[model samples]
Target: MSQQAALLHRSTHAIPKTAVGGQGCYIFLEDGQKFLDSTGGAAVCCLGHGNKNVQQAMIAQINQLSYCHTAFFGTQASEDLARFLVDSTGGKMTKVFVISSGSEAIEAALKLSRQYFLELPTPQPQRTRFIGRTPSFHGVTLGALAAGGHILRREAFRPLLTKKTSHVSACFAYRGKKDGESDADYVARLAAELDAEFQLVGPDTVCAFIAEPVVGAALGCVPAVPGYFRAMKAVCERYGALFILDEVMSGMGRCGTLHAWEQEDVVPDIQTIGKGLGGGYAPIAAVLINERVVKVLDAGTGVFRHGQTYQGHPVSCAAALAVQKTIRDENLLENVRRMGEYLEAQLRAKLASHPHVGDIRGKGLFWGIEFVKDKSTKEPFDAKLGIASLIQDTALKPEYSISLYAGTGTVEGVRGDHVILAPPYIVTQEEIDIIVNTTVRVVTDVFNSIH
Candidate 1:
């Protein structure tokens, strides 16, 4: 049978069908099934599949220089990509450290944050701990995992993870906002909680406050309230701590802006971005250091004490450069905004009235639909129900032929159900309609069967 399965799959007993081909938001299975990629493969395929420009760029780079270590020589592809990213930020971010994945980028950010404090004239090595939000996701590596607040993902590794990082409540309105609390009051309350945590941890001991501008995965596409980011940044500033934003799943025009923090009127000292950076064309992520931090480092050590073998892979950089250029050349950000409004309207019109649908919230092209057992009570379905997982499985059925991003533990990282929809920026009205119809049908069928 040609070795039915030798690979260790995510689930020990279940092996997914092999995908042989994909193009422009659709994946082809070996069994002649075509599935619509509504979640854009975890929101990474921003430019969709089979992009000729990105492919050509990668090929060209390979023909010239495939790989070069940062410790030795810098390639043209890497330099150009860095310059493009810095210019995109209007020089707000002065330097870039290209890495292999989002986790690595976050790791770099954390280390750089610590190093920045040390590089200052009045060094405070006591600033060693980090503060992140509960029900947030940073990355999967130990340091990054420790910084994240995902209960389920961190459960097994809790004993091994560092305890230096602490967490506070996220600025999630659907569940976090009380019945009578106004937006200003909610922001104040959250800010108070953060300030209290800093005091509890000893303000000088905290290094930075890290969070996703738009919470993804752990709390599924939840955005902050109007004045939330400003308040959080203020708290960080008061403690003399760096403000780090993890835009891995929300940056690179995924949220209708080049940077998710742009809409909030808050600038981060250090930022990490991935997913859409290379748009699934190659593995690439980066850490963007603001001028303030770069200046301190340049005056002191003049070197970041970190190194990776493939720190700035030329071919990967070329692929990402090409992908980013395409997003700009095609004016996809405008399409993201226009199509985002249309998609949200369609979703609300179709599913907002469903008895189980509790919340439909997001910005730009990123949206999350959270399901509940009782709408009036805002009570989430039991974890044992695996409601979100069921919907995702049903979405991929041959009859439906759709892919969804499912997340669990939305409420305090223990009990909640939600699915995210982040289609490619190039998605059209027809594709949006198909996605909406399929999602509505899938959610309805899953709940109907359970009921």
Candidate 2:
């Protein structure tokens, strides 16, 4: 085995079989097992696998000019990609900063938010803290890790993590809502918690409030209760803190819209996107800044002060441009909405009333199933049970052939379990049925065996 195999086998427990090939909506193992990739490989493959256009785009770019440093020359592909991103936002987003991964996009957003405040006079020198929500996931990068709230993921690195970040309760209505609270009241309470956090830290002393429009990884695709984002955005505005939305997993076409915030009706000052942005064709991510945020930099600093040699590389940009155009030209977002409704119906009809299923929630093709010890009580499994961990494994059985993205500590940072299933936008009705049937069977079997 190569060092890659050894490292994954030893360091990452419960690693899956080798994915020798992937096409359309499935990944093939070296042993000839074809796993239905309902999770779209972490919701990355919006264009499905083995997209010919994206491949050709990459090949042609590499053949022409593979590796030109951004320091010396700018690429047409990067410029075109920027135009596409900005235009996708209806000109609301004026500028696009390219980066390598979701984490890098987040790192850039964090830096940009801080720099936004720096452009302000005196800029409230004490405004160094960042506000995030419990059970939120930003990224693994240092700045992103500091902003994230998963207790287990942030434990060992606490010393190295930034100390100024604080967390508020997430608007997870399934678990966090009061017994008899209305949606309006629940959103109010969460907003109050955020307001209190800002006050506690002195609003002017905070840099930005970061959150995923739809909670990914940590909370299993939980969208905020109605009015949650509006309230949250109001609070941030009141405090003079920029609202940063991490739509890395939920944005692009995953949520049936170009921007996840579009559904919420409130745009962020700085938005981070990745995963489906390039449809997993190449490593690419970006930070989309609104005109207001960019104006501060242009007027005050005259520069963003952030750049990487590969920041706007030609090949990555070309791959992403092709992916975005393919999505738009193919009219896949409509399919996302239609198929999303079907998937939701199947999940609800098949699994919602199951004894251990706590919640089934998502938007567009991105969806999640939360498991619990008792659905009636909304109590979570003990972390040691590893409900999420085992589901991802059992679903990949030789006869079954499925891949599920498992997440734990969804309730807080160490007590709940859920598995996310975001299939490719190109998925057919037959494939959707296969995924639903396989997942429901595996999930039901897991709980029955455990109970």
Identify the leading candidate in terms of lDDT: 1
| Clash count of each predicted structure | 0, 1
- Tens digits of per-residue lDDT, candidate 1, 29-138, equal 99999988889999999988889999999999999989877888989999999999999999999899999999999999999999998999989999899999999999
Q: What TM-score against the true fold does each predicted structure earn?
A: 0.99, 0.97
- RMSD, candidate 2, Å: 1.6
Cand. 2 TM to true fold: 0.97
**In TM-score terms, which candidate is top?**
1
What's the lDDT for candidate 1? 0.94
Model 2 per-residue lDDT tens digits across residues 1-451: 3434655463464455678998999788888898788888889999989999999999999999987887788888899999999999999999999988999999999888888888875565677889999989999988898899998888899899988899999888888888899999998888999999998988888989999999999999998877899999999999889999999999999989989999998989999999999998889999999999988888887788788878987899999999999999999999999999999999999998898888999999999999888777888888898999899989878867887899988866888889999999998888889989999889878877887
* Model 1 root-mean-square deviation: 0.9
Model 1: residues >4 Å from true position, as ranges?
A: 1-4
